[model samples]
Structure formats: C-alpha cells, structure tokens
Target: MNCYTLIKQKILAVITQLQSNGGLPADLKVDAITVEPPKSRDHGEMSTNVAMVLAKAVGQPPRVLAELFLTHIQEFDEVRTADIAGAGFINMRLHPSFWYAHLSTILKEKEAYGSSDIGQGHAMNVEYVSVNPTGPMHAGHGRVAIVGDAMAALMEKGGYDVTREYYINDGGAQAETLARSAYLRYLEALGQDIGEIPSGLYPGDYLKAVGESIAKNYGDAFKDQTEEEYLPFFETYAIDAMMDLIRDDLDLIGIQHDVFTSETAIVNEGAVEDVMDMLEEKGLIYTGVLDVPKGIEVDDWAAEPQLLFRSTQFGDDVDRVLKRTNGEWTYFAKDIAYHFDKFERGFDYQINVWGADHAGYIKRMLAAVKALSDDTVTLDIKTCQMVNLMQGGEPLKMSKRSGTFVTLRDVVEAVGKDVIRFVMLMRRNDAMLDFDFDKVKEQSKDNPVFYVQYAHARVYSVLRQAEAQIGQIDEVQLQNADFTCLNSDDEIGLIQVLASWPRCIEGAVIHREPHRIGGYLYELAGAFHALWNQGKEDTTLRFIVDDTKVTLARLALLKAVATIIASGLNLFGVEPLKEMR
Candidate 1:
C-alpha cells in the first residue's frame, strides 16, 4: 500500500529491463534512485529522480536519460501520464484506478498497514526518564518520558523487539541526600518542631508523605541514630517510596516501563569494576591529567595524573574520567557500567532519551558504548527540549507540590493524560514545545490533538449515519467496496494521503523520529475534514447518497481513516475518541 515503494519497485523493474536489453548501462547502480511525491500534485501523483542518480554514471546528460526513462514508464498500464520535469526528474500521474484499488488494501491490512519488518526482531533497549529517585518528576522529565515511550512504541510497530527502560540514579549522593531529607520530615512527623529544611536537602511537600510513612512504621526507633546507624535503612526506604510514587505518576500518564534498572544494583554487583576491567583490556582506559577547558579558567586547577578513558578516540571532544582524584568512581563510570549491562543483556541497539540539559554528555556516553561493544551494539541518544508550561501566553510559576517546578502529575491532572501526552509530543523532540493550557483546553482547530480526534469521531459519526440511512454496509460489502465510485479529485486526493501511511511509518522509524507521525496524522485529519466540508456543500459528495454503491464506497474510506487514526493514537499512548464530549 506504499505508493512510493510500489513505484520504486516498478522503476527498478524498468531499469533492469533496460539493462537486459542494453538500453542503459548493465553495471549501473540503482540503489541511489528514489521515487517520491512531487511538491505539487498538479505536477503528477509521483515523481522519480532515477535519471539524475544514474546519468553521470552512464556518461550521458541527465535530460537525455530522463527522456529514455519517461518513454519506458509511459508504457506502464497503470500510468495515465508521464512527463519529464526540469533537468532529470520524471513526473507521473497514475490512473485513478490504481489509487482506488488500494482502498481495499487499506481495509484488508487494517491496523497493520503501516507496520514494517525493519528491525527484524533484534533486541532494542530504550532507556529514558532516568531521573534521580529523589522526588516527583517535573514537566521536563515528563516530556522525556513521553517521547521515549512513544518512540519505543513506534519502534515496536516497526518490528523491533523493544524494551522500555528506566534507569534509577539511586547509587549516587542524591539518594543519600533524599534519605537525610526524609529523616527531617520523619522527626517532624513524630511531633518534633524541625525548622526549615537544610539548604542541601530536598524541600518538596511530596516527601512529607514519605517521612510520615517512615514514622508510622518505625515510631522514634532511629530518632537519635548516627549517619552510619540510620543512613542505610533510610536511603532504602526513601528510594523505594519515591520509585513507587514515580511508578504511580507514570501510570497516571499512561506510560509503563518494561524494566526498571537500579544504578545501585549495577555498582553493588561490581559492574563498575567489571566495565573498567573490560575497557582496560581494550586499552581504552589510562591514567592521565585532563587539560583545563578552553576559554574557562579554573580557580583550583590541577595537573596531577588521574584515571581517564580515551573517549577522544571514539569521537568525543576529549577523554573522560573514569575515577576521580578522591578514588571514587565518577558518575560517568556508573553510566558506562549501566550501558555495559544493557549490552551484556544482548541488546543489539540501545537508545537513551535525555533532557536537553544532558546534550553535552552524549558524545562521552556514545564513546564508552563504542569502546565497550567494539562497535557491535549501536547506541543512539535522543534529547528532548524542555517543555515550557505556559498559561495566558506566559510561563507559569513554580509548583507548590514539587516545591521546585511544575510536577508532571499536576499538569496531567489539570489537563488529563491525553492532553498532556499529545501536547508534549506535538513538536519534535529536539525542538522546544509550548504546552499552552488555554490553547489545548480550547476545542478548536488550533488544538492538534482535538482536531485529530475530531476527525476520527467524524468518521464514526458518518459511519453511523450511513448505516442507519443507507442500510447496513456489512464487512463483506466493505471488502468488496466499489472504488470506481470514488472518482472525484477530492476523494482520490484523500485516498492518496491514506495510501502513504506505510511510507510514513517506515520513514519515521528509520529516522528515529516518531514526531513525524503527529504531523502526518494532522495532515490526514485535514484532508478528511476538507472532504467532509465538501460533502456538506454538495449532497452528491456526501458519504451517504441515494446510490447504495457510492455510499458504501465512501463509508469504507471513512472506516480506513478511523483505523489509521486509532493505530497512530495507540502508538502515542493516547486514546482515540470515537465520540468527543
């Protein structure tokens, strides 16, 4: 059902025939050639640049090669017209019969129309929302989480054995800080008048519940305990509570991770030491001093030797430190260990979805993966720009719950999970997005999620009307839908858009950008809405007509639209509404 792929195959057949008959060079490489939709449908339904790709290889001008291909493609039984555009591009208008036939293809394929076997079931690990288990997630964390979850879904649709993962930074100093922060709340829960929280510890009201829980369980048992006596139990308790809250928050927004990897477990199981040994065996680790960052003077600069990894050999700007002068493994060391664990678990591909603040950390992590896997496992790091929570055309103030920023749960609760998921993903992951409360809440075309959902609901409404007025259009009738009844330009144009779903998904998965699906769905909805508007003006253009055949044909098309939208919304983890309230 992918027109581009179908046309590309036919053009390849043409090239092969020409090669066989010696009309073109026998040794020409056709892999670089492409067939795509033209800038304007007025030019043609599809276009190809085969001549431009192969002209120089054959020692001929591109226009001459274009003419040769045009003459051959004009003989295609399905082609209505074939013309040469500027230089070497060939534009083609396929017969409406060609597009009409694919409508049945849509009904037959159903939700599997856009699916692909690109991944071939290879294991893929997508690690995202790896925030410290210290507090509730903020809007930025929510954006990353949604992007990662949706991207994983997209990959799964593309046939990758995808696993969504969350790496908890519980092994670091932040977890200890959280435990100490909870201890203060614990004392307060026991009727002690603890003053304002210390500056370095968490100050969120959300942690108050964690402290109260601890007090309720162990009333005053460790009130006077030292750091060594209370730190272990408190750290474990706080992280477990925070992680449970995080899990609940994720559930509130309809995201569920397949695996939750603990950073402390990685370190506690000697993964950090094992990862270092593997790197040392590969001669990637060394003892050296890092140069001071250029244009930035350090007040306490040192030239002493330290443990480092030769990350520069693998495209990083500079080598990275594995161990600090204090003899403690750096945070980067733990990250390398975590990725190594993913690799050892047999993930052929790993993707990390990080917030924009972590952009500078990408190269070193990639370098470590390359070094450890010897380029066997591929790693891709996607960064989601921060979400600007706007109200009345301006950024909102900090949240009272998180005490630092707007909590993800608060926004989801305010607008509902569907709105939060859709608006957060309304833009490219690497581009800044404005989640405007006033705009998304308004049920207008300006709201993309609403527009898309309305398109879906309209299709269902039309289907209901058609069934009641034109009699039941059963599954057999739809399977045998008379596509010739759909001869109007607008009818065919919408079908053309619908036919491109498989191509859209394949490209999205290949580029590692599922944001494209949002744009595609918007365009699909626009086309569908345009046709619905047309039907309103001309009764003959209506989906339900006196002629039972035309009514059934158009109803089949509407069903296809609903199916595609539902498939897309399922990937976004958002519900596709059959009726909007």
Candidate 2:
C-alpha cells in the first residue's frame, strides 16, 4: 500500500537484474541505496540514489551507471519515465494510475491506513506528567501530558505495546510541606484563629476543602496530636486530594495514565534498598565526597561525604549522590529503583517526559537504567520547554485562582480542549511555544487547528451537497467510482500526499516526535484547500461535475482526505469537526 516502498522495490529489482547481466559488480553494496521524493516537483515525482551510491564501487562514473539502471527500470509499467539528473541521481515519473490507486486503499483502510507494525509488539513504558502530587497541574505539565499521550498513541499505531504512566513524588520533603500546609487549614476548619499561613506552608485555598474533610471525619481526634503523630495521616490525605485535583486537570485535556506509581509505595516496599544493594554489588555504589557542581560557588556550597552512584561511568559529568549525609535516600535513589522495577516488569524500552528544568538529570537517569538493567533496556528522555501564554501580543499574568501559575484547567477552559491539545503540539517538545489566546481561537487559515478542522468540515459539506444534487452516494458508490477520471495535476498531487501518510507515521514513531503528525496534517489540509480553490476559476475542475463518474471519483478523494485527517487527529486526542460551529 505504500507507493514509495513499492517503487523502491522495483528499483532494487532492476539493480539486481543489472548485476546479473554484468552491467554492475555483483558484490556492490545495495543496502545504502535510497528512494525518495525529488527536491523539486519539476525534476520528477520520485528520485533514487542507487546509481550514485554504487558507482564508485562498480568502477564506473555515476551517470554511466544511472543510464544503465534507468534503461532497465523503464521496463516496469508503473514507471512512465526515468532520467538521470546531476551526478547520476535517477529521477522518475510514475503513471497517474499508480497514485490514483492509493485513494482506493485509503478509502478501504480508513483510519487504519497509516498504521504499521514497526515495533513488533515490543513493550514501551512512557512515564510523563509525574508532577509532584502537591498542587494542581500547571501549563508546563499540560504540555508534557499531551506530548506523552500523543507519543503513546503514535507508538501504539506503529505497533508498540505502550503503557502510559505517572510517577507520583509523594515521598519527599515537598510532601511533608504539603501535609503541614493542610494541617493549618485543618485547624482553621476547627474554628481556630490561625493567622496567615506560616512562611514555609502552602497557602493556596485549594487545600481548604482537604482540611474541612479531615475535620469532619476525625472530629477532635487529631486536634491535639503531635507532629510525629499527625504528619503521616495528613501527608497521606493531602496527597490523595492533590492527586484528584491533578487528575481533574488532566481529564479536561483527555489524558489519563494507565498506572500511577507512588514513590512512597516503592520506598515502603524496600525497593530502594534492594536497588542500592544491587548497585553496590556491581561496584557502582560507593561512599564518597563529591566535587562541587560547576557553576556553584564554593562559598555557597559545602561538600559532604555520602553514598554516591558512579554516574560518570555512563557519560555523566560527575558521580551522583544517592543518599545524603543524614542517611536518607535522595530522589535519584528512588528513581533508580522505580526504573529498575519497570525493567523487571519486562518492558523493552522506557521513555520519560520531563520539563526543561530537568535536562541536567537525563544523563544520570540513563546511567541508572543502564547499570540497573545490565544494558538490557533502552531509555529515552524527552524534555518539554516552557510555554509562554499570550493574548494580543502581551504575556498574560498568573491566574488569580491558582496564585502561583496558570493552571492547566484555565487554558483548557478558556480556549477549549481541542485547541489546547493542538496548539501544544504545534511545536516540538524541546522548543519553546507561544500560546496566543486570540490567534489560536481565530477562525482563519493562519490558525493551524482551525485550518485543519475546516478542511475536514468542508469535506462533509461537499458530501452533503453532492448527495442532495446527485442522489445518495454512499461508500459503495464512491468505491465504484471511475478513479482513472482523476487525471488533473491537482487531483494527483493530493493522492501523493495521502500516499505518504504511512511513511509519515513510521518517521514520527521512529523519531519519538508526535509534532510531525501535526505538520503532516497541516500540509495535507493545505493541499486539499488548494484543490478546492482551483474549482473557483475552472468549471471543469469542480468536484460536482455533470458527469456522474467524475463526481463519484472526486467524492472518493474527499473521503480519503477526511479519513486521513481523522486518523491523525485521533493520535493527537483532538476531535475532528464535522461542522466548524
């Protein structure tokens, strides 16, 4: 079904025939040969570098080898012509029938047209949105959430067994701080005149409900308990409430993790101790006084002897501390155990989506995975940069409700879930994104989400109009259309874009970049829009011509465009609009 792959196979067959006929060396390496689209449409539809790559090996000039290969390849019925370009690159033009048949394949496959079996069922664990369960998720968390979700969906489409996961940082000093903050609110709920929240405690109003809930359930039972007695209960209750808030924010953007792994649970199960023991056995763990990190002033830092991981052995700049001088395990220690647990669960690959602030942690984390898994598992870490929220070219301030930052819910509620998801993915994860409220909501071609959705809506409108003017044209009728009537350049150009969907999916999956799908969808939409506009000047170019055969063929083309759009949108978790209202 992949036209490019089909063409490449024919080119390879011709090269093999040439080798048999002594036109080229039988021992020449053909693995490096590649078939791709020509740089300019004027050159040809497809181009290959087989001749150029094999020329030096075969003891012949590139042009001479290219001519021989072209002579043999031109024998194929699908390739209308093959010509040698500069330096012996072979440019080819295929028969229009070759492109037109892809429309039938798209119509039959529908949303499944671009799906492939590249992963071969390898288990991939994608951990993202592991924001501390201390408060509502912010805009940065939203970006990672969508990116991770889309990546998981893309991997699944490419045949990877994907597991969406969230790692809760509920066993740290931050969790204790959250507990103390909730306890203050709990005192307030009991009618205690506790003045403004203490300097070190959380001051957000969102915790008031958690305080009230505990006051109602336990009554005066915990009113006079010591810090040691009440800290555990408050910490557990606060984490649950905060996690619920985080989940609600994710729900607004259609994200739900398959597993929520708790740091506290892993620590309580002695997993951290076990990992430390394993690393120690392998000589990766040691008692050491680490050098001061670069960029840190000596006067502002103090070095303490502690248990450290030999992260430098795996490309990190320095060894990392696994336990503090006070003997408590560091966050990195628990993370090492968590990743080891994932490997123990039998995942072949692991991916972590982190914020740009955590870029320095990548090497150490990868080192941990390598050491713990004995190089049996591969880990890929993606870092999402900051999102700058703007309106009318001015940066918007923090939300008054959240106090500290713009909550994910605020963005989703303001511009809607579909716009939020689309705009977030409009750029790659490593690039900074500007989310303009006015511009993204604008109903024009400048807005990518609207432009793509409008294309899909236009297809539905055309179908409705076609049915009303030429009797009902269902799937059967469209499939029976005389597709050979689609002979114009515009018609063939659209099919070419549609035919690249599978290739696009494979590329996106391999690169672990879902933003490519957004780019492809935009290009596909532009191509369809251009063809639709062509009808305005030429009456013959109109989709609904008087000829039933021509109209049916055009309808089939429209359906194929709509189907591919829907398929791409599904990977992004964005809904395809049937109508633009």
Cα lDDT tens digits for candidate 1, 401-465: 78789999889888999988988877899999988888998887889999999999999888888
Put down candidate 2 lDDT per residue, 438-508, tens digits, no spaces. Answer: 99989888999999999999999999999899888779888778899889887888889999999889889
Each prediction's TM-score versus the true structure: 0.98, 0.96
Give the distance in Å from residue 85's predicted Cα in candidate 1 to where it truly belongs. Answer: 0.7
Task: Name the lDDT of candidate 1.
Answer: 0.90
The pairs that clash in candidate 1 are none
| Per-residue lDDT value at 48 in model 2 | 91
Worst 10 residues of 1 by lDDT: 467-476
